[model samples]
Target: MFRRLKTSQIVVDVIVAVGFFVIAWPIETITVTGALGFEYRLGSLGSVLAGLVIAGLFSGALALRRLSPALALVIAWVGALAQMSLGRPPGFADVAIFGVLYATAAYGSRTVYWAGFASALVGALVITVYLTAGPMYAGGLSWQTLPLALVMLVAAAFALGLSWTIGALVRTAVRARENRDAQQRAEAETAAEQERVRIARDMHDVVAHSLAVVIAQADGARYAAAADPAVAAGALATISTTARSALADVRLLLGQLRHRQGDGPQPTIADLEELYAQVRTAGVQLRVDVDPAAQGEPPAAVQLAVYRILQEALTNALRHGAPGGAVDVRLAWLPDHVDVEVRNPVEPGAPAPARVGHGVIGMRERAQLAGGGLDATEEAAVFTVRARLPIGDPA
Candidate 1:
């Protein structure tokens, strides 16, 4: 695919090209009279036609410097050859060579980038030989001429090498910046994805668990309304309270999803009491065993994970366990970690469900996020979910 050109850079290059043409419209050439002696000469202003053709080619290269640096380099060579052929001296127009070489290294593709380095080395040698050729023709070079030739070669090499090196450095810096930008974008995307999954899991736990209790209470209230009005009324109250709480929790989750502000504290281990009360109110016998910790409470991440996992497991028990069946919940807080286990008897008549439900998946994800592991299984008519979350562990 063709990359778009930078209009501003093209404009600047054109302006610079115009400046070179204005300064060197009539080109000149250098000539040496003696080989060994220090007798040098400069050619008179060359023919206007030769100057126009040579300078125009170099200016064209300058204009195309950033637009197509490889082509610009070719044009530069063509201009250099034309000046040598026309016996013209280097002039202000040759100034475009520095910009063209820099662009080739900074903007060109890999092949052209290396070609720029080749041009720097070979062009220096060509300049050194061409400038001294006249002196050699007049009087063959001797030991006296060696130092002058060496100086010319070293000077040419230094100027050209410096320009290419600066451009190469720019290329490296640009690539590094691009890599950093790409990495930041990827990290941001990953964080957003994780946030989405968390919201979905929380929503599922709240809605599914709350609705299951509301349904169980509603059914029981309908059957008991004739036998005991007070019992039916209490069931209705529980339903109302459960529904309001669920609505509030759902709203809280929604608020978190909608905006960054108003993010309240999440449920922790302490909230398990309210959860158990709700399960009992739904006509399920919940037996909870708590093994307190000597190391105080765990990290917030661990508490949140424990609460959510237990909530989900009990929610499953309420939804799929034997009608009025008993559930056993255990929590043991150790120095380094907290362990959670929930066990409920299954109804013999109830069909086997998919081994892992969405609730179970959400529980597993919560445990893993808190730097923990979870296992949920059904064996011998009993469903169990166990989790071990590390305290203050890096996630």
Candidate 2:
């Protein structure tokens, strides 16, 4: 409840209050005259005491203007009426009403703002009536009275209305700035979340596919060691290479949390040859066919999607297909899109892979995110995965 007070605002209020207190009596006695041409002249100590008391009330109210504008406005108007009752002319303390009006518009609630505005209208009417009907113009209203009343009304309204308008403009500007800041914060949060999901999917693809290759190579080396030492050594080499690539990719993904940097190198369509060789070493006879004329280079994002989709499909074949079954990979690059198809014969007795495995889901998500489509199907003892990814302007 005890928040820090604004030092600058307090300093300004104090200066205004002290200035009003010091000048209220002197300025009236020296320069200002009554509406009836009567000049201020101090007759006794009581008049001085009354003047000081009224100034104190006005100054005190001014000090709390920003803290509670409605309360300050009430106190200031009361002080103004007191000065008028004593036939005293308007003093410098009257300026405090404008500041109070500004505070109401800037910080006060809806009721307070409307109350302050009503006070302005009522105060103007009261001042005009007091000048024309009070002892200052006791001879009765004359031709000059209407103009004088109009001047008073306009002056009062202008002073109070102008301050309120300025405060309202400031309030509008502040709210706009706050809204802009909130929108930017929300956008930043959304982008960060998307990045996190992308990284998670990449990790799933890398780890799952690598582990499948490592298992296949290990199993093959165990069986081939007695038959041929060279074949076992080559299998061990493939396992080591696959494991190192997976480790490097994982490290790069983890580093993203600590620093913002390029993702180094990502596998693309050009690396499919290496992928095919790795699958061949894993004991799967792989056939890859590419239409040379259709090899127009695709965008990097599409290339990455294509590479990951193909990788995931082949990994599944290695894990679930018959040990000696043949796998076929076909690539067709078109003007606006690229199509990839991988097919393998399902093992006779082994159950077909799940229609929505985690790996398949990851592939589908990747393809769709790249503005593409993917399909996986099992029919006639064969499992097939196909994807079509948009490129260039289509992306």
Candidate 3:
């Protein structure tokens, strides 16, 4: 309840009202003289009651300042007029005018703010005329009185103008802060969307590669089951292992939805041997040649990119290339980059893969993100995937 009250605008305004009342109530004497040739003073119990009542009216008006600045300013002006009617000149109760003017400039609409500015000019003129024509000055429309009246007019204008200007400056600052926060939120959303795309690409690579291997092994097992049961058992074991690994990877990818980065290690260039063994077990003739210098461990990010590129290339070759065709993989280490090339024979009369295929798009995106480039081409029944990735610091 206390927390709620603290957060409530009405409660905060009430507290401000109470504070203004406390400060303005004790001042029973007004500084300026009235038309009666004497300074206005409230010196009796009845007069004290009148002053407190005026203070309450002013404070109550101030409490509504933020909610309705135009209304609050009008109400405070009414209280000022009542005080003047009671033979009181300018006094502490008039301080509420500053707050009301500030609210008008800070929160009021354009129509309301312009109206408040006009009111300020008019109010300054009225105060100047009233103070100069008072009985205490003992003169009317004289050169001596004119100078004092002009000074009073300028002083009043300056005071109100300062309050309004301060509120206007505060309004500008609040707008700037809100704009900055909105931009930050937009950037955060963009980052989250990019992360989701990355996860999706990773999931596709894992599932597609595992499924291709399982299909190949299942087909081979079906043909060999009667002739050699042992061979079929080995094929079954390969399918089971590949399925379990794929399931684990899928779980890790889904965990990201809950903002959890799983503790599982990411596959890297070192995992290429296992990947190669899997493809060979699926009956594809595979040959790998890695440059000795490039075999040195690279940064984790570059290694992960290399592994995904290789995995996706092998999966495509096994799925779409001629059955029992030879796949050639070559890795060359240069001074600044590592180059990977995979070539497989396309079956005769087989249509070339679509240029906008999701698998090819994912590989291209991954290569570019890793500071590299990738290209796929089909020429004379030969399919090729080539990628060049920048090498990071030795790991």
Candidate 4:
């Protein structure tokens, strides 16, 4: 509730209403002139004080709550009647206050807002007729006052209608702003969730692929220790290298998760050679046909995306491709674009692996983030994964 009203606005409203009543009460008293057949006097302290109190209360009530239109009209009628009976003579000035109040309340959708306007108009007409009753009986009713009364009524109605329209417009604008803010907040949350999922996929690819290679090498090392000590030592060396690379990858991923700005080294297209070496050590025969032009330069983000895509593809191949089968990796740098392909031959009767795993999804996401395209297909003993990245602008 406090959020809805400004302190200064509330203060201003209170002061204006109180001040108007204070000034209007004395004016109403001064209107009590002689020979009007009304027992009103501006010099009467008690009557002036009483009128001031009444007017103050009336003004304050109008500002307080959601006043009904009917109640407002009744108050208007009563005030008009009092002003006519107690003031000097019946005139537009006597009932103008009630008309203004009625219009405000009616436009505000208060209970007595419209009613107040209607009642004030009616009361004004009644007072006019009452003042001219004796003369009309002696002669005839005059039509001169009709135009003035009609003008007042029209003005009041117009003011009320315009204010109500403005209020409705303001409400609509406020609601639209609120809806837009809510939509923005929801979109931000969804983007954050998607980032989280992408990070999780990266972790899965890094850990699973590294551990799988380590496990295979350990097994080979244990088996060849007696027969081929040199081969066992080589396997141990591969294990150590795999473990260190895995640790570095983990640290980079954690830095990304923590939102650390430029905290870790990012892999680029050059890192693909090292990645190929790791896969080769894992017992996958990797045949590479990389473009010399694609060896050195790319945008940092694009480079990272390319590296991740290749990593995921290689990890998937090692997990599902036939043991000892050759995995072919092709990188071609066109004048305007870069193309990457990873394909492995599948053994006969091997079931297709899960398609929605983290590795596959992560590759797809990375390609998309880099403003590239990727396709995975399995047919006739061959599994192919291809990505095409536009080099026109860095991601």
User: What C-alpha lDDT values do all the predictions have?
Assistant: 0.82, 0.80, 0.82, 0.66
Ranking by lDDT: 1, 3, 2, 4
Q: Deviation in angstroms for 275 in model 4? A: 0.6
lDDT of 4 by residue, 258-290 (tens): 883443676777778888888887778999897
Top candidate, metric lDDT? 1
User: In model 4, which regions exceed 4 Å deviation?
Assistant: 1-57, 62-142, 157-169, 260-265, 299-301, 354-356, 393-395
Off by more than 4 A, model 2: 1-54, 85-87, 134-144, 292-296, 347-357, 393-395
Best by TM-score: 1
Give the alpha carbon lDDT tens digit for every residue of 1-395 in model 3: 01122348878998999998998877743344444344654557756776787888789778888888878888888887777667566668888888888888888888778877876888788777766784333455578668878988999998987888888898899889999999999999998888889888999999999999999999999999999999999999999999998999898888876764643578977789999989998989999998745655687878888889889998889888898789999998776788988999988777654253588788888889888899999998889999988887432
Model 4: per-residue Cα lDDT at residue 370: 76
Question: Candidate 4, after superposition: displacement of residue 390 in Å?
Answer: 2.7
Query: Candidate 3 clashing pairs?
Result: none
- Which RMSD does model 3 reach against the true structure? 4.4
Error of 2 at 341 (Å): 2.4
Task: Specify the poorest-scoring 10-residue window by lDDT in model 1.
Answer: 29-38
Against the hidden reference, what TM-scores do the models get? 0.90, 0.83, 0.83, 0.69
**Candidate 1 Cα misplacement greater than 4 A, ranges:** 1-3, 26-46, 134-140, 260-263, 293-295, 349-356
